[model samples]
Target: MRKTSVLIRSIFTETLELINISDVVSKSIRCDGSELIVCGRRYDLREIKHFVIVAAGKAATPMHDAVVAELERSPHVWMNVTALLISPTAPRHERANVTFFPGAHPTPNEVSREAAESTLSYLSKVDGHTFVMFLMSGGASSMLEAPIDPNISISETAEFYGALVASGLSITEMNVLRKHFSLVKGGRLAVAASRAAAQCTLIVSDVPSHSSDSVGSGPSLPDSSTVQDSISLFEGLQDRVLLPESVISFFNGPLLTETPKQTDKAFARSFHRVILSSTELAEAATRLAKASGFHVEVDSTCDEWECRDAVKYLLDRTEALARIHPRVCLISVGEVLVQVHGRSGKGGRNQHFVLSCAMELRQRHSHITVLSAGSDGIDGNSPAAGAIADWTTFERARLMGIDAQSCLDTFDSFLVFKELGDAIMTGPTGNNLRDIRILMSDHEEHAIYHEF
Candidate 1:
């Protein structure tokens, strides 16, 4: 009989492989001579005079490297062709043709503001026949910002993000508000690039449904959010004093235009936005489980499912199976949101969920391995994409002088997992599928005690 814990670990491994950066990057990229294809169309670099590459989000480094490899000759690209990376560890500036800036994610910082301003400056020089390649991935919202309101600083924007995160808003909803508050978002970049030789956007989707407009707030696509929607997104947090006066003025004033109903018609003429990567990794993960000789089942749940509900469903199902056979593995995908309340701790949704699941599994000795990770290699507001936990994870914490209860109570999964050494780190995987959770049976428990 197959060990339940091994089977569960296999499932988790499969899921990670499905969304592996190499797989996603390979699938999205194709090169033929001087023509490089991103989404579908082919662009001949030889035909274009100036090539400017702009990348934002966690996937920047991979995307940048991919673009650089496609160039036939180093001289074929111009020194003016700059690369902007939102994440901290972007590609280095070895070649004069390329420039790199490390920005922030989830929240804006001084460096992010500078990067956004630099991006806008690059836009000013774009003209007809200027080849503009846009690389977008998760976390571009804050990294690609250009202040619509001059008085608003990075501090205010960061503060707003902090509050929004605490309020437990969806990425799409938060981006809707962000688009109204910035000039670079909502396809404005597309509009600018429309004046270029040809604009192509390569997106590694983090959104569950792969909505082009929602990912990175649709820098190269039409934005469907309005100011009214932004106000509503704030809800009770509207008067919380988290936002700056300039931000307040922009929100309250008439300057914040509703995002375009669709991509600018000019965008259709000048640009092509392609979704190169997404939850396909989930399918890969599914296949990996089956190939490993485990009876595998994939639940294609809607991304809109709540995290708590999803966790509950997993727990309930796992428990039921334990009651019956006690040797089943469940794999889950899609991002989950966590609403922060009072003196919260430091951890992303994946961490929080794992912490919660660990707490439940602590007493039952279910031997679960709740492995939640972002495909792009970073979870919300944290460096580690996600974490892994088994029944012993809690006990291990106790042994290490860490209290799981207090950590969860403070909503700090990062610290909890860090102490327990269960944090999953992959850097930037160049792929995104939101989060993956794998519930396993302890391998030792099945091998040593439960021989069928």
Candidate 2:
């Protein structure tokens, strides 16, 4: 058990190191005096009279710092450099030229509105000689916002988001709905930066497919979704979630506008690159597992699966793999959905996943250890990032007189794991790339080795 725990920790640490915001940004973007090179594109910085950085998301501060460091390395091209950063947390740097706005996440608030207005205000000042650099990541949809209609209050927006969260829809579906209602999402930011000489967007993708337009609702990239798609998605909720009347009306009203598309002139000078993705994290974990003398099997992206089905599928595969290989590690990446019915309790999808697996593992008396976590180090509303479970997790719950199924049904896996000391906590990891699930099994492992 100790060796297995150490191996899991090593894999997790290695994955985080590979997706470090500072390292990703520094490696993907560089400014060399006259030319600014990012993901293979080159822009002559010498001709630009002004260079502005607009960044928002979980890793906004670190990403901004990396860009600033690269810019400072080329002092000749550092003239007129300014920045506007929006994040769920406070600024990490105290740069006079960089304005920081701390916004709400998982849901938008007045601060989110303020940040959106501030960003637009800065973009409004850009001229033909300005070069704009946009940095975006997972939480941007909630951290930055500018609604197209004035009648839609922040509370209405919050209610809309709440509905989406409870709708059991994928992130892509929710983001598609989000892009239609905002003024600065779905390529609107690119439209706002149209006056700039050139624009570039660097993305740290949290979406399953690393869709450039879906990350942060694709503020600086073309949106392929339409108003009809958003309406259909909301309608498919089938009364499982409730939306504010204003929100319902907005979707039904004539005020709905399609987001900027590929044909828009705003993209003429815009270049987008997804610098980091969840697949990279999965690959990093695979490498670590192989180095530890375990046979690694990576599952395809499981973005569309519900929490229950995803856990079942991975566990079934792990069991089969363990029979053939003495040591096996199965990795799966992507966000899973959890349908919250009635009064749902505290716990995110990852915790729910781990709890569900624990139930099955205990029933089968399997000697497998599973760890599920959000790469961003935050799982839902709980303080814990996620949870770890083994064959004995259910036994521990039974001994404590805790009903595991009851917890799973009520969406209260957080409490179950907390009581068992199986919760994985790593305060906000400054980066987001979706979630990762690691399942390990050893053919000769016994009951004694299953105890954490």
State which candidate has the highest lDDT. Answer: 2
Q: Encode model 2's per-residue lDDT on 133-190: one tens digit a residue.
A: 9999999999887678889999889878888888898899999988998988999888
Local accuracy of candidate 1 as per-residue lDDT tens digits, 1-452: 23443455455555665554444555665656667676567777676777778888777777777666555344445443566556656564466656677757667888877887788788778877687878888788877776788777778888877777666667787788877778888888777666787777777777756566788888877776776888776555574426666776777787877766554664765554545544576667667755754344445363545667767778776666545554455566776777776776668888888888887777665655667777767776677878877666677788888998888888778998877667776776655556777665434455564221
- The candidate 2 region of ten consecutive residues with least summed lDDT is 443-452
lDDT of 2 at 17: 78
lDDT value for candidate 2? Answer: 0.85
Per-model TM-score on C-alpha atoms:
0.86, 0.96
Q: Estimate every model's Cα lDDT from 0 to 1.
A: 0.69, 0.85
> Which regions of candidate 2 fall more than 4 Å away from where they truly are?
447-452
> Which candidate achieves the best TM-score against the true structure?
2
Model 1 spans > 4 angstroms off: 1-36, 43-47, 73-82, 239-241, 270-276, 300-305, 319-326, 362-367, 380-383, 392-401, 426-431, 441-452
